[model samples]
Target: MSGLRRKLLIITVLLAAVMELIDTTIVNVALSHMSGNLGATLEDTTWVITSYAIANVIIIPLTSFLTTKLGRRNYYIGSIILFVVCSFMCGSSTTIWTLVFFRFLQGLGGGALLSVSQAVIFELFPKEKQGVASAIFGIGVFIGPTIGPTMGGIITENYSWPLIFYINIPIGIMAATSCYFLLTEPVIKTKVQNVDWTGIALLAIGIGSLQTVLERGQTEDWFATGYITLLTVTAIIALTAFILWELHIEHPVVNLRVFKSKTLSVAAILTFITGIGMFTSIFLTPVIAQRLLGFTPTQTGLLLLPGAIIAILGLMVSGKLLQRGVSPLIIITAGFFCFIFFNWNMFRMDLDTSAYTITLNLIFRALGMAFLTVPLTMLAISSLAPKDIPQGASLNNMMRQLGGSFGISIVNTYSARRVASHRVDLISHITNNNPLTIDRINSYTAYFMLKGIAWDNARLKAMGMIDAAVVKQSTLLSYTDAYFMIGILFAVTLPLLLFVVGGPKITAPKVIVSDH
Candidate 1:
């Protein structure tokens, strides 16, 4: 393929990938609008997000099998068409359930956009330049979710909620039309005569149920909810059975044997850990800005923009360093420390902190992730046999997605518990016998009295104000605690870097071929 066509194909795939990823978080800020417009409760509207996530987790690991069975070009183009159709349906739906159903369908297609697109990008470049490919793809991966909230906020605030879903249509159509003409089928195809029906069933049930549990667990109070308990048991059983069945068969759907490569295994684990930090920070920062700092959705999104741009520079610089023979292990180690520093700085944030301070801390986060994303991609599949690369890539991507889910769940539950604990401890010090507490209440009462309230009523309002203050302060403390937990998690995982040996000579990806 010529340079121009290669660049066009890369841009086409990256656009599609970014569109899919952006959809994952774009609906978040619009949940209230969706709830009001659809005549549903806030919780019901959230299924729009949860349903899509469940579909993504289930379908991601199956892409390698689907691509082989359907052919790469056919599968890629088909998925894009499906995604576009679903986006239109999602936007046009008048009912909540209808929208959720189509969002789930969109996710099924979105999974291939990520896994297959990564494979295609890798195939576009030569063996020695795979790091550049990873860097290029990393831009889409990192920036897609980073800017999603910003775009969603802008669209939702200025227009309507449907615009978020509608926006995907034009981009998806463009990518599909481009790929249909430029993308080619793999010349050497592996035909599957006997489909792994059992593996597919178990995988869907296991991953789908697990993802749902993670998405809804904190909202439903974890295992205390009956369905959460049932789903947890079902997930454990189904996943264990799926692993055993896959390993026992001659041709498995997911190819569990790929884990035998030590480098791939270590890389997968590290990716999982990285996903925890990468996603949890994105999840936490916006909430802190909007809930405590009095920032609007657009302001919060704008706070992240500078860091997102800096992240692009970080990605390119790290990619060049890799091309110039800087060890991935060294790059990855540096990424960990950068991330640790980001967490530490964020942990020091208080209610009085300014947006500029938070933005600076987030820039460190962007740099850490930029350094990590490309190097990790290069490391994961570098040692794999060319034939196993797709399966390896699929598994690696799935791990990252799962890690994000787990991280969000853990932090959500932890923050809630800490808030309750902190609130209780704070309230205990507000007894009548405490002079400072009495004086604080008196000052509040005087402030209310100055507004012309009677003494008795002013005292009551003062006590209510104290309660509100306790809850607010507790929440703030919990957020800082959450940041510290994220930092400590990274600090503890640093030793895993020691286990990463250098990957072997890299081979070009075998999954894609250009029809020039």
Candidate 2:
């Protein structure tokens, strides 16, 4: 392949990957608009996001099987076409159900975009330039979600909510068309195996249920809801059965055999830990800024932009270090320490803190992630054979998403509990007999009276204001506690790094022969 064409293919696929990734978080900011426009309750409109996530989690591990059954080029192009069409359908839907259905389809298509796009990118580069290849791909994986809210906010504020879905139409079409003409199929040979229909069903039920429990657990109050409890049981049973079933079968929808590799095994563990931090930070920081610091969605996204650029630079620099023979282990360890620092700094943030200060802390996170993302991903499949890399890659991708799901669930549950606990601890000190409490209540009463309220009304209003203040301060304390806990969580996982040993980076021969 010519250098120019190869770069174009890379760009084409990266665009598609970013588009898919962006959709995962883009709808978060537009939920209110969607609820109003679709004539649905806010609670019902959450399906727009949850349905998509369910589809993504279910289809992801199955990509290797699908790619093999369908040719790589065919599967890639078809997924793009599906994604583009689904985007149009999603945008045009009037009801929440219609939108959710199309979003689910979009998720199905989007999973392939992520799992297979990286496979193609890896195959395109030579063994020697794999680091550079990973650097480019890592940008989309790490930055796409960060940018989505920014883009969504800009569009939502200026245009209608549907535009969020419509925006993907052109980009998806461009990527699909380009891949059809420019992308070559990588020639990985394997014998035709019988379809594991039973395995497929088990996996879908298991992973789909698991994702639902995670996505809705907090909303439904965890195991309290009947369905949540049922789904939890189903997920555990189905997943255990799926694992046993796959190991026993001649053909499995998702090949668990990939985990047999020590390198991949260790790398997957590291990737999971990394995913928790990577995703939880993205989830927490945005909420903290908007909810506590009073930044708009657009402002929150912009706050992340500088850190993102630093991350890109970090990715490039780390990739170069790998090419120049720096030990990946050393780079990864340094990244963890940097990440720890970022989390620690975030833990210190208060309502009075400036955006600039937070931005500086986030830059540390970006740089650390850049160092970690490529190296861990490269390590995951480095020791696998050419043919197994696809399965390896898919498994690693699935783990990252799984880790993200777990991270979001954990953070939400923890923050909510902390806020409630803090509120109780704070409110307990308030009593009619306490001198400071009485004086504070009097001050609020005097202020309310100045607003022309009756004495009794002012006193009532004063107590209400005190309650609001308590909630606000407790909320802030909860977020800070989450941040501090995040740093500690990542730090505790540092011992897992010991299992990661050096290996020759896997590089496939020219599996892709140019058709032209």
Candidate 3:
């Protein structure tokens, strides 16, 4: 391929991948707008997010199979077209369920965007320059989720919610068109000997059930809800069977044998852990900014913008270092510590934190992620045969999505319980006999009285204010605890690097095709 065509294809796949990832969190800010506009309760509207996530995890592992069934060029373009059409359908839906169904379809298309794009990008460059490819793609991976909320906030606050989905239409078309003109099928194509229908069924049921449980568990009060409990059991049984059955099968839909590679195995686990920190931090920062500190959606988005921007350079630097044969372990270790530092800084944050401080703190996160993305991608697939790259990419991406889901669920439940515990502990000290408590209440009452309220009514208002303060303080404490725990989690996971056998050897992928 000529330099120009290669660049265009690179741009095309990266754009599609970024679009897919953006949708992952973009709908978050618009859920309320969607709920009110569609006349559905907030709970029902949440399926818009859940359905997309479910579709993503389910389809991700299937991308390798799908690519074999359909040629790479055909599969890539088809997925783009499918995504574009579903984006339109999602925007046009008048009902929440309708929107959710289309969102699921959109996710089905979007899943391939991430995994396939990674494979294609790696195929674009030679082994020695593979780090550059990783860096290029890393920019999208890091920036996509980072800017998602920022873009979502801008659109939700300034424009209609449907515009979020609609905006994808032009980008999707451009990507599809470019791929049609420039993308090529692999010179050596691999075929599935037979369709593993049973493996497919097990995979769908198991992964789908597990993803659903993770997405909805907190909202439904975890296993306390009957459906959540049932799904939890179903997920365990189905997943165990799926794993065993895949290993037993001749042609598995997902190649279970790839986990035999120690590098891939360790990389998968590390990716999941990274996903927890990455996605959870994104979740935590915006919540604290908006809920406690009273930042506008745009303002919260802006707070994250600088870190993401600075990380672009960090990604390039890390990729260059890898190209120079820096041990993947060293780079990843440095990344881990950067993120732990980020967690520590955020743990110290209070309601009085400035946007500048948050942005500076997030730069650590951005750099941490920048360091991880390239090495992890290189490490995961470094030992795999050329043909197995797609499968490895699929598994790696699926782990990330799952990790984010689990992280968000765990954090939500933890924060809720912590808030309750802290509130109770706080309330215990707010007795009438406590002089400081009495003085605080009296001060509130006098403030209300100055507004011309009756003494008894003012006193009642004062009590309500005190209760609100307790709730707010408890919420702050709970988030700080979350930050502390997350940091500890990162610290604990660092030792896993010792298990990585050797530095990654990024070889040129033979699976990518030359221009026709």
Candidate 4:
């Protein structure tokens, strides 16, 4: 390929991958709008997210098999087509369940965009230039979540929520057309002799059940609910059985055998842990903006723009350094430390934190992510044979996404419980017997009375104000605890980078095994 065509192909796949990842977090700010428009309760509306996530995790590990069946270029184009159609259908949905159903299908299509795009981009460059490929791809990887909320917030506030989905149609079409004409399929030497329907069934059931439990665990009250318990048990048993079956089967839905490659195995672990911090930061920031800082959705989105801009340079720098043959572990180690330091700084902030303060911290977060994105991705599949690259990419993407799901669930549960605990502790200091507490309530009552309120009404308002304060303090404390935990998480995972081994440079000649 000429330089112009290669650049265009890279740009095309980058957009495709970014679009898919943005959907992973875009609707977060629009949830309230969706609930009001669709006439669904907030709890039921959450399924819109859960359904899509469940579908995404279920289809991700199966991408290699699907690519084998359809051919790489065809599968890529087909996925884009499915995504575009489903995006339109999602916009047209009038009911909550209808939107949820369409979103699930959209996820099935969108899931392919992440892993397949990485593989395609790497293929565009030779082995030595793969770092540049990773650099270009990593920019989109971090930018997606950053821009997602910004775009979603802008769309939801100025227009209706449906515009969020409608916006993808044109981009998807262009990407699909360009890829069909530009990308080539790799030749495969061996084919799966038999299809493992049993393994596929077990994987679907297991992963689906696990995702549901993660998304709904807190709302369903975890093991306190029979259904939650049932899903949890089903996930455990099904996953175990699937693992054992895949180990012995002639053809597996996921290529678990790749785990035998130390490079791929450690890369998967690091990627999984990175996902927790990466997604959770995106999740928590918007909530903080709306709930604590009282920023509008658009304002919150704007606050993230600077970080996204800075991360681009960070990605390019890291990629260039790696291309010069710098150790992958060195870059990863630096990223882990930067992320931990940033998280700890966030833990120390008060409610009075300025937008600049938040944005500055986020810029560092993005930089940290840029460092991890390219190296971790390259480490996972760059070592594999051309035939195994697709499978490695698919598995790596699955682990990262699954890690995000697990991270969000855990932080959600921990924050909820911590808020309750903090509120209790705070209430203990608010008793009537305490002179300061009594004086504070009396002062609030006097302020209300100055507004011509009756004594009873003023006292009631005073109590309400105290309750609100308690809730606010508890919320801030919970956020603090969550950030602290994330810092510790990064620190604990840093040791794994020591054991990472990069695959040797590719020297084998190419073989064509495409169905085409």
Model 2 TM-score, 2 decimals: 0.92
Instruction: Give the per-residue lDDT of model 1 (tens digit) for 39-155.
Output: 998667867867777787788889999999989999999999999999999999999999999999999999999999998887777666676677778888899988887888788
Worst 10 residues of 1 by lDDT: 506-515
Task: State the lDDT of candidate 3 residue by residue for 1-516, as single tens digits.
Answer: 897788888888999999999888877666667889999986688678778877888889989998998888899899999999999999999999999999999999999999989988888876656666767777888899899878877887788889999999999999998988998986557876888888888888887788778767767888889999998999999999999998998889999799999999999999999988988888788778777888777787788888888888888778767666677788889999999999999888877889899999999999999889988987888888888888998999998887876777678678777999999999999998999999999999999999999999999999999999999989998998898888899999999999774645643222223332
lDDT tens readout by residue for model 4, 1-516:
777787788789989999999998888778778999999986678677667777777788888888777787888899999999999999999999999999999999998898788877777767656666666677777899778989989999999899999999999999999998888876453475677788889998998888778777887888999988999999999999999999987678787998888889988998988888888888778777777878788888777788889888777777667656677777888888878987888888778888889888988888888788888887887668888888888898888888887787788778888999999999999997999889999999999999999999999999999999899889988987898898899899887887774454322111211111
Local accuracy of candidate 2 as per-residue lDDT tens digits, 1-516: 887787788889888999998998787667767888889986678678667767877788899989888877899989999999999999999999999999999999999999898988888866666665677778889888767777776787678778889989889888988998898777675655898999989988997888778767877999889999999999999999999999988788888988999889988988888877887787777667766677776777777788877887787778777776677778889899998999899888878889899889989988888888888888887888999998999999888877776776677668878999999999999998899999999999999899999999999999998998899889888888887887898799887777764565432122122323
lDDT of each: 0.85, 0.83, 0.85, 0.83
Shift in Å, residue 71, candidate 3: 2.0
Candidate 3 collision pairs = none
Per-residue lDDT value at 395 in model 1: 92
TM of each candidate vs. truth: 0.93, 0.92, 0.94, 0.93
Scored by lDDT, model 1 comes in at 0.85
Which runs in model 3 stand beyond 4 Å of their true positions?
Answer: 35-46, 219-221, 505-516
**Candidate 1 clashes between residue pairs 3 or more apart in a chain or in different chains:** none
lDDT of 4: 0.83
